[model samples]
Structures are given as structure tokens and as C-alpha cells.
Target: MASGLFTFRGKSSARADIMLGLGVAAALILAWEAVARAGFIQPQFLPAPSRVLGALWSMTTTQGLLWHAFVSTMRVWVAFLLAAAMAIPIGIMMSSYRVVGASLEPTIDFIRYLPVPALIPLSIIWFGVGEETKIFLLWLGTFFQLVLLVADDMRRVPHEYVEIAFTLGAKPRQVLTDVALRAMGPTLVDNLRITLGWCWTYLVLAEIVAADSGLGFVIWSARRYVKTPEVMAGVVVIGLIGLVTDQLLRAWHRRMFKYL
Candidate 1:
């Protein structure tokens, strides 16, 4: 059992992994609770997990926490989906043709390296202090990175696969669609999963300037009032949502590519 738990680069039961992860999390939470109770830190600075939980309940019951969370989730999904839709095709084109890659890769690299927060003023100016501005910020954060990942994934497809398809009398389009795309499907899905997480990371930045209803707004509002527990609760909700989303994507990936 110890060997099973401690193996290096070896497969273990999923149940064991889940249990171990939960155990570590529980230990950390208990330690935090102890520290808070012992007055090692002021509650206002670092509230006990129990207090945070209470705050979460209160917010949910009276402060529209669930509505804010739902709004944030919707914004994230919409932006991420739009980014994926545009990036995947552009990436495929860039990888399949030298001209496309040469023309676009440099521009994408230049823009992606620019600090996203720095563009917030421009985003608001262009789209106004509305939903469009928020979505654009979220989309901008995800698209550039995802496009590069998609192009790399396409490039990493084995050359021999494309060659084999060509030798079998396949046309250029068929080779690209049937061989390259299929070969890179798993990596593309994985990249999409990673970039979706990035969209969530930008949520607070997206909503910071002009947002009335979002987890970001809730957290920012709480900070102004020094409502530490409420702020922590909002952050914890985002973390939980991201974790569940990542796990769901992993499960879908495994199921979709069982042979992998």
C-alpha cells in the first residue's frame, strides 16, 4: 500500500489519488483553523475556514453570491468558447502553410507578450463599461496563447502520418483534415483545457473596472469593506469552479481518446 501510494512515474488507483489529495487538503484546512483560533493572525486578516464557510452561506442566502458566480461562469465560458473557435482554425492554417505562419506568428507573439491589464483602458474605451468590454478582456487573455498552442500541436503531428496519407493518393486538404487534424486532436483538446483555466484567471481583471455582478465584483467589493471572510469565500468559489471544470475536461479527454 505504501509502495502504491509512493510510486514514482507509476500508475496508481484513482481512488487512492483522490483520497490522498483530499487528505492533504483537509490537513491544511485544519492547520489554518488552528492558526486562526490561536490568534496567530487576526481573523480580519485570515479568517478560519469555518468563518469563511459561514460567510459563504450568508452571502449565498442574502447577497446574491450564486447569481454573481453564475454570471462570472457564463462570461468565462462565452469568452473561452469564442477564443477556441477562432484560434483553432487560425492555428491550423498557420501550421499548414508557411506564408500563414510567417505572417501571423510574429504578430501573435508580440501582442500576447503585452500585459493584459495594460489593455484594460483600451478595452473599456473601445467597448464601453459593459459586458462587451468584460468579454473582450477575457477573450483577449485566452485567444493568443491558445492559438500558439494549437499551431504547435498541429506542427507536432508526426511527419510520417502526413507522408503516408499523401502516398496513398490523398489530396492536400484530405491529408490536412484526415491525418494532421486527427493526429493533433488530443493535444488541441488539452490546450483548450489549459487556456480555459487562463480565462478564469483573468476574470477579476476583466470585471475590475466596470462590473456589477460577478465573483470578481463580489470579491472586490468585500475588499473595500475589509470583509476578509467574504473575499476569501469568493476566491474559494472560483477555485472550486476551476477545479471541477479541469476534472471534467480531463475525464472527457480520457473518454474521447481511450486509445491514448
Candidate 2:
């Protein structure tokens, strides 16, 4: 059963899916370039893909945009790690104990509904306009939702597994660490991947407050001068980073949980 979860027999179909996705992406870019060149869309508003690529090259070569992208990536990693470290343990406790779950779930759900953008002013006041503010905002954006996701995953662990552990004379701690966490590890990683994507979504918001560097700052700076191509370039960089990281996480998941 475990092997079945990871080992698909349809290798050809998987390859076809990849090909289809690439074909669609290429078609869209070609269409976009054609529309821009035909003057249907003004370059100021929506630059051609080639123009955007040129802008990206100029930024990387002359404006140190690569450094800015690196800084943004680092900030995302720091925030994601911090949130995961706290959420994973708390989520486990919430799932294991009725009292804990009941006491915290309502509060977590309430906080999750509070928009991260609405807290921007307060975060600045509390942490100042520095890396702390950005990191805090990113954490705030993902932590509450992730805690709930982790808890839900934990609750889905099979009761039969736990019963078998108990029948084998396993202690509570053993059952939790040796059995439950082991079983839930794959799902937890999957949840982390989802939450990491959310972290990327919040990256621009995090860096926009007082940031002088990063892709968000680049976009804002371009906006001031109406450098639409540069702005698009920055956005494209962010999207590419998110896509690459998401794919890496998926690969890691497949590698680690071959039985999933």
C-alpha cells in the first residue's frame, strides 16, 4: 500500500503532463509578444516578453537586482523556518490533547481571519522598519494558518496505528514520537510546502514597508518612474523564485516519502 502511494505506473502520462504545461506556457508568451508588437497593448502598460527579458538583463547587470533577489530569498527562508519551528510542535500538542485543541483552535482561527496587511502599521510600530518588521510580517502571514493545517494533518493519523502501538506496550511519548510523528512526517512536509508558498505571497508585503532592497523595492522604485518593463521584470523574478522553490519542495517530498 505504501509503495503504491509513491510509485505510479504511468511514467508516459507524467511526461505528457510536463510537455503540455510547457506548450501552454510557450503559447501564452508568444501570444503576449504578438499582442504587444501589434500595438494592441501599449508597452508602457504591458511590455513585450522580449522587452521584459531585456529589462531583467539590464537590472541584473547594472542595478544589482540579482543581489536584491538573493536578499528576498534569504528573508523568505528565515521567516518560513521560524514559523515551521513553532507551528509543528504546537500543532502536535493541539491534536494530541482535547483541552489544548479546544482552548487554542478558536483563537487561532480568529487570528487567521485578521488580514496581515491590516497589521502592517502595527508591525512597523512594534518592530520598526527593519528586517525584523519584514520577518515578523511574513511569519504573521503564515503561522496561524499553518498551525491549523498541521493540526488537521496530525488529527488524520490512523487510530488503529496508535492502538497497535499501545498494544505493543509503547508509552505515550514513544507512541507520539516513534509512531505518530513518523506517520505524519510526509503530510507535515506537504503542509510546509503549501505554507511556504504563502510565505512567498507575503514577501512583497513584508519588504514594502521600509525595505530599501529586494524585488519589492525594485518594483516600487520602477513604479515611481513608470518603468513598466523593469516593474514587470521584478515581478517575473519573484514568480520564478516561487516556482523554483515550490518545485524543489515537491521533489524533496517525493524523494523523502517514496512510500507516500
- Candidate 1 lDDT over 1-260, as tens digits, reads 64666667777787888888999999999999999999978899999999999999999999999999999999999999999999999999999999999999889999999888999999988999899998999989999999999999999999999999999999999998899988999999999998998898898878767899899999999999999999999999999999999999999999999998
Instruction: Give the per-residue lDDT of model 2 (tens digit) for 163-219.
Output: 999999999999999999989999899889989989977889777767999988999
TM-scores of all candidate predictions against the true structure: 0.97, 0.93
At residue 11, what lDDT does model 2 achieve? 38
Candidate 1 off by > 4 Å: 7-11
The best candidate by TM-score is: 1
The number of the candidate with the highest lDDT is 1
Residue 257 miss distance in model 2 (angstroms) = 0.8
Query: Total clashing residue pairs per candidate?
Result: 0, 0
